[model samples]
Target: MLEKTGVPTPEQVKRAAPTEDRLKKGPVAVVECFQSIPCDPCQYACNQGAIKEFVDINDVPIIDHEECNGCGICISQCPGLAIFVIDATYSEDKGLVKVPHEYTPLPEKGEVVTGLDMAGNEACDAEVVKVQSAKSLDRTPVVWLAVPHDCLMKVRGFRRKGGAE
Candidate 1:
């Protein structure tokens, strides 16, 4: 049920990965759903219809990555917190990532925090670019972080200052 390192397997990543061409178009959502759970919020959250409607409630989502504009809507709508928005074109030296955050003491905009990877390993320092908590989000805060361009793909989330959750 897990990859060699006890996380998502290579096949799972491949299934959820967007095409390199789509990624080059700018920021896009990456749905990391490896299991076929009965979920579809991501599909409807995408105003562009980039996430296809599931034939069955239990079916996994398929991304039309080209249609994705990286609006970061699906990031807060996903119940599994599996959707990530990556923008490699944010700048020449930085990248942007929008991640779902449910923890307390949410980092403020412009604040610096430690970035962590999927396995909770420290990746790099990240700056909070924006914090979206619109009423439509239903309590799930979507945090946007600016990280080093080189660590863009490696960063999955952020940690509070002083190693706090």
Candidate 2:
């Protein structure tokens, strides 16, 4: 289904998601990479060593949720845009999701944007909390959004209001 639609099935997403207990612990990286491509930047970007070393160059990443502090350093390093950091404990009603943004005119902090699901559908309204575009990120900017707690997993991307894509 993923090869046909470019969107991973729900079951695949479940397998990539961290456990409920791990989510409650705080922010953690969620590697949604399912394909076995020759990629390992996420593992190398993790200073905490949370992303396990690849046994093979094409092996999918294995994240040690306990070791990840959810700093989101790996978010931008992932060329495939498969890495994200979720902070469920950010608030009782909201959660923080850090996603990669490669488009021009990035969303500004405090701006309200339309959160999107895996299939690029509208999921919810999210507030931009932070935008990290350090030179160290290699030009991939990471946008932090605060969305409803219920949409923590659903909101994977966002569309800036009246902004060019």
Candidate 3:
């Protein structure tokens, strides 16, 4: 969850979508994170000083979206299994969740998968629409998928068909 100094919080993200309508005509959250490891590449990745010190590297890096302009610098710089971008207004039918997936035998873009919540429970269905990877993004392979609006904050991970649990 992003913690922009003047943006929103986990609670605000829950209260009412505090995100700009990117699909329409505004900015959105670009989180390329997944794990809670001891790192801060995302913090250093941000030029607007959006992602700041985690206080503890083990803690998830927070993004100040107000200060952030949806620049995806942190998305490709993160080393842990954490980070993602959530456009709450991606679509009226569904919200797009771009998660930093690094599992081997990666799924193709347009593939469908089960979006798992924090508890690893299947909360909703997500389909990969875009796959961003390069020598720079490392081997993590940030996968961009679309999910339900209500499931955005709940989703934490995903598993493909016949994939590991």
Candidate 4:
């Protein structure tokens, strides 16, 4: 349930899912996040010291897969609900997209959730595979969605259709 406003497209997700071979040989690279409000947890979460040394805390997170373990520690640390993890290397059937899911009545694994884009509009349908959270994540659940190969670049977020916050 994206907003009645600017919704993202699957093509955007595709364009956004560009590959970085360096991540495969080393740590995972994080991208596709455009919003800069209320975030910067990635700096403190990176135990390897890859993020802090590379940029300022106020700056956006620039992950160096060379040191990233894809541990997803930073995925939950975000506050604006921005940021995600994408693995285009996954099988042809689908790929992994880790998002900061912070809505009530969160969808369950295997449940078909509504895929949304940056503007908070419907883009496609995706399946929820993993939903994780810890006290450190600040109540934000790191939702892993199994999205169609085509939806990779378009589906930036999720929408539950109708509900109250």
Candidate 5:
């Protein structure tokens, strides 16, 4: 039911998808915010003002992808966990994706885990490249995964070896 109607279609993602060059430059914020809610934390969280403030709280957040250095400060700031930092230049054959992980038993660095797509489906096996859980993050851990270059845009999150926590 979700995939058929609830989840975004490929065409939609393609329309808003960042270019390969942009992804390769450095880390960029990929805001998957599709709904309108009273939220402006993303704009305030970014010290660079990469994310524009909404005149109306219900307006969706607007990000100047070019201005985003992909620092990932907004990742944890977003209460909805709708932000992702994609670094296509992580390696020649690998890309790094930073996702917000709120589940317990957080995966450690260098751990091999199942990468999940936007629809929460296993997309590939990825290695945990980095795990940041600073106090400023307020318990929201940012998990970075080293996934195949081709899956840079596809991989969104990760699951532990045994199963999802």
Candidate 6:
């Protein structure tokens, strides 16, 4: 399915996902990079040394969940927009997913947005918790979204309210 379509399969996603025990700990980086292309920015972006050093540039990133603090510093560094920070322990009913955004008319903080899944389909309604657009992040800005706990993994991207699908 991944070869036929750009979207990854559930099994592929599971390979990259941290363990349930890890998720309950706190926020952590989730690298959804299924392909082994030339990419290493995510490793360099991780200050905690969680992302293992790549032996070959084409190797897929291997994250050390124990070392990752989920600072989200690597979110904007990914050119493929594959890296995300998920905090399943945010609240009893809610979780936070930090995704990279490069679109115009960025969703404002405290605004409600239509959360999109990996297939770019509407998953649920998410609230914009924060927007980090510092110049250091290059041109890509990171958007922090507060979504239902069940939608934590489902919601990877979002569309502004009444915005284009």
For residues 55-77, could you state the per-residue lDDT of candidate 3 as single tens digits? 88687666666676654556656
Which parts of model 4 are misplaced by more than 4 Å? 1-29, 32-40, 54-56, 161-165
Best by TM-score: 6
Which digits, one per residue and each the tens of the lDDT, describe model 5 over residues 41-136? 888899988888779988898888888999999999999898898898888889898999999888888999999887888999999989999999
TM-score for each model: 0.91, 0.96, 0.71, 0.72, 0.93, 0.97
Stretches > 4 Å off in candidate 3: 1-27, 30-38, 53-62
Let me know the TM-score candidate 4 reaches against the reference structure.
Answer: 0.72
- Model 6: lowest-lDDT 10 consecutive positions: 156-165
Each candidate's root-mean-square deviation in Å? 1.9, 1.1, 6.2, 4.8, 1.7, 1.0
The best candidate by lDDT is 6
Give the per-residue lDDT digits (tens) of candidate 6, residues 1-165: 988877889998888888999999999999999888987888899899999999999999999999999999999989899999999998899999999988988888999999999989999999999999999989899999999988988888999988653
lDDT of 1: 0.85
TM-score, candidate 1, is: 0.91
Given candidate 4, what's the lDDT at residue 109? 73
Give per-residue lDDT, candidate 1, residue 12.
Answer: 72
Per TM-score, what order, best first? 6, 2, 5, 1, 4, 3
Which pairs, if any, clash in model 1? none
Comparison by TM-score, 1 against 2, better one: 2
Candidate 3's TM-score reads 0.71
Off by over 4 Å in 5: 1-5
Q: What residue pairs are clashing in model 6?
A: none
